[model samples]
Target: SQGEGPDPYDEILQAFKIMDTEENGFLTLADLKQICESVNLNFSNKIIQEMIEEADNTGDGKISLTEFTSIMCQTGRFKYCAPK
Candidate 1:
């Protein structure tokens, strides 16, 4: 179900757009928290920190769309959520 959708790319892009606070093609820890909150998902600050460290390839304290998508695809959630 990795790519099962009318527009998986659009869905991914929209997720990134929502998470990118500065609109500079990167998502910060705050952006991650905000995105989770918007979906009513509660994640600890510790977990968020770990995710950021693990996914933020550039070590810039921000994650890019490519990195986020890679993580989501691995988690198997991208298949179900529609573009917001």
Candidate 2:
């Protein structure tokens, strides 16, 4: 199953809240690296670069909240589950 029943937008927003420490609408490569580190997810620089390029829709060096959320869902890293 995909997981919980919360609205996808809400899920995305929650992800954004977690990633966007600066409260800015965009995330830098450093931000992505930090997230990877926090999750103990070992990722190569090439993979990170590809993720940024694939996820950063605006063509800017940073990724927007929406973009980040979409990537997370697509990657199965974030699953919406019921509260335990």
Candidate 3:
């Protein structure tokens, strides 16, 4: 997969899979927090909650693959979101 060139989306999805260790098609707030920590993103709990609110369009308080992908693809990065 080394020569595939610029597969940031794929990389992000793979990370999503790894983070979603429960494999339940969604991530709890706790799970998201752990992921942020594992990647050394260093976000506060409030920031994580804000991200969840922005991505969890269904108001279920969990992030599904669709929602995660939407956010990741939209931002095209994983360093957290802020108004550009």
lDDT minimum window of 10 residues, candidate 3? 75-84
TM-score of each: 0.68, 0.65, 0.68
Tens digits of per-residue lDDT for model 1 on 1-84?
455547766788887897887788888878888888888989998888898999988788778888888777777676535345
Candidate 1 similarity to native, TM-score: 0.68
Candidate 2: regions farther than 4 A off: 1-6, 69-84
lDDT of 2 by residue, 30-51 (tens): 7777889899997887788888
As a TM-score, model 2 comes out at 0.65
Off by over 4 Å in 3: 1-12, 77-84
Kindly give the number of clashing pairs for every candidate.
0, 1, 0
- lDDT of model 3 at position 32: 84
